[model samples]
Target: MKLSLKKIELTPPQILVIGFAAIILAGSALLSLPIASATGKPLSFLNAFFTATSATCVTGLVVVDTGTSFTLFGQIVIILLIQVGGLGFMTMGTLFAFALKKRISLRERLVLQEAMNQGSMEGIVRLIRKVIQYSLTIEAAGALIFSIRWSFDLGQAKGIYYGIWHAVSFFNNAGFDLFGPVTGKFSSLTAYADDPVINIVSMGLIILGGLGFVVISDLLDYRKSRRRLSLHSKVVLSATGILIAVGAVVIFVFEFTNAKTLGTLSWQGKIWAALFQSVTPRTAGANTIDLAGMRQATQFFMILLMFIGASPGSTGGGIKTTTFTTLIGAMIAMIRGKEDIVLFHFRLGKDRILKAITLTMIALFLVIFVAMVLSTTEEHPFLMILFEVTSAFGTVGLTMGLTTDLTDFGKIMIALMMFAGRLGPMTLAYALGPKTEKELYRYPEGKITIG
Candidate 1:
């Protein structure tokens, strides 16, 4: 008799999914420990799992108040999860590899390429190094600013701790806030709504995080290279600015007289609240206003923004800004009777257009299906269910007061949605499907009717 072992190979997408899931499970285990709870009792496994999933996915929807329910050790675990999730596990792996002076294998590079959503493996290592440098630099600056402002409000020790915690949270777009003791549990940034310093710094961190690291790298390199921005960067920047501006205006207009939200604020306060609210809805879940009190129309509009979400390779999620831009470009091209979709004088390939459509359609279906399920399983209103579903699918973390009241089933489903959204629907699909094989011949082209 002979003993034999078979080696198993995993695709990059499979590796990413498993990596995130493993981190989430480990985080859950740590959180479930007695020391992790504020009251010195182990948190429920379900609550811990949900919290871990939310943290690891960088989706901030919480069943337990993070600041009130968890101890310092727990919060540190959460912050670590957010950092890894925001940067992707591969990025952290690369950091460890660097610390040990170990070479990243070719297979690891391939996984990194997929994790970062890069077009090629070339310069992947360099990009990861730059990502580390840029992320730490930005977070440090934000933390310094926060500490300076908060030192007058709180003692020096508390200010520094709060600064580091929140700076990381905001920069990673994690939306996890420790304002529970100062304000109220689940209050998010509402206490700082009128504070110009808080509003500006928070929004800046969110915007930078949502812009995607690749775009940041490109912008940084532009000064040295003196070349035009890549089409992807151009589209991301344009879309982000336009969305923020439009979202701000719409929110200000709709909530201008809503007393529960913006009406009680001064003119300056109103502007700050409106701007911050607009920015946070796009995958940054920190809210300066009472989201549940916002006008239904405003909430629905935010749902759209949440769905469009942040750019690719960004800490934030959703179908991605590039996907949205590509779909819009394709629509415009079709309306103009053009043969190809063009942006910045560059024609997009058919594959790119098809991928965008597929991604958007899949995302739409996922949100809809989850919303339907939640609506049926929970006692919340349909709008609230839909909002939560979109938030989960977009990894946006915005909610209409439905998260804490969720049944266990709802929590699990939402957690799964968060996981799917973080890895991306396409990646999951690819990972589960059979390996790609080129067809010998193409099928005949067919035409379809249009509206």
Candidate 2:
């Protein structure tokens, strides 16, 4: 008798995402074991699950203090999850497949196309190869710089490890720190903020990682061949610059006299903190100040920054800077009664506009719905709940002190939000199954009176 088995195939994105979720869940379960904790006590299932999801999503909201709760092994697991999550499991899987000399199927290419948001698959394999190469090179450089700086403060071996871990965490925007109470101590980076080496290196890593691989690829290719940058790259870079500059100026001006966080800092420290705060909310969660102690205005500003996070196809999350920019352009065009939405001399198609609007609407609804649910369950103030929801949905992870107090249901809600934020609502919707095509019908174009 002969028996044959059938091969099961999944789109690259689906396999990558589902496989990562499985790995995270399993890792969380294993880490929940008694031996995984620094205190040798097993963590509750919910806490373990929450931590795992947060790490895998590269979101830093934690149910327990990472520094005190988990052992080094557990922390390593979390870091690994964050790194994988940040780079994306599909990219890594494709790289391994390529290394193994496995031929990528057409379906896999389509999945890859979706994953990278590429316009074509002609050079996707090469692109993935370059992405891996560039990511590792940059991350290694960041780790080395951090390691040298940390060596002066911490011992040699520990410093090297911390440097590598934090370099990955910060660049990936994972925001998981093992600095103990010092994580929240917020000395304005006074101890290391002015180190120049640490600040510059960390900021560089954050910016490069958040810039999106497509932009990096374009820049690299352009430098090699002296070509012009793509319109997408132009838009992304322009928007990013404006947001960073505006955010920094606003933060510096507002907190100059708060006396609690930025006010007490020296001029140099204040500028450094302001820059860090501004850049961080673009979805990188590293902080030079205590977030809990910030003024209400600063927090509100942060909420806005977090909502318009790093660029598309980047390690960070949120609606994306490009999406936000495109929407703003569309709005301006509409206000001027123009039919075309152009940016950087390139016209954005209606499909792109519709998609952007849909993404923003879905993201907003998710945040608001989760906030309402959490407010009811946790009894937190509306603003705090909204902040937490936005943080989770943006995968920004800069919480205003409500992460640990969430009930089981609330934790699950947040986990779902993080997953949605990272994978994207549209992608998740696609993965759930194909949508039904509209049957026969044409609706009349109707206009409604608006504000």
Best by TM-score: 1
Error of 2 at 21 (Å): 2.3
Model 2: how far is 48 from its true place, Å? 1.1
Q: Please provide, for model 1 over 357-441, each residue's C-alpha lDDT reduced to its tens digit, 9 standing for 90 to 100.
A: 9999999999999999888899988999999989988888888899999999999999999999999999999998899998999
Once superposed on the true structure, which residue ranges of model 2 sit more than 4 Å away at CA? 1-17, 181-194, 438-441
Error in Å for residue 80 of model 1: 0.6
Cα lDDT tens digits, model 2, 56-129, are 88888888878778888898888989888888877888878988999888878877788877778888878888
lDDT at 183 for candidate 1? 89
Q: By lDDT, who's the top model here?
A: 1
* lDDT by candidate, in order shown: 0.93, 0.83
Q: Rate residue 207 of model 1 by lDDT.
A: 95
For each candidate, give its TM-score against the true structure: 0.99, 0.93
**Clashing residue pairs in candidate 1 (N, C-alpha, C atoms within 3 angstroms):** none
Model 2 pairs in collision: 189-193
The alpha-carbon deviation from the true structure for residue 141 of candidate 1, after best TM-score superposition, in angstroms, is 0.4
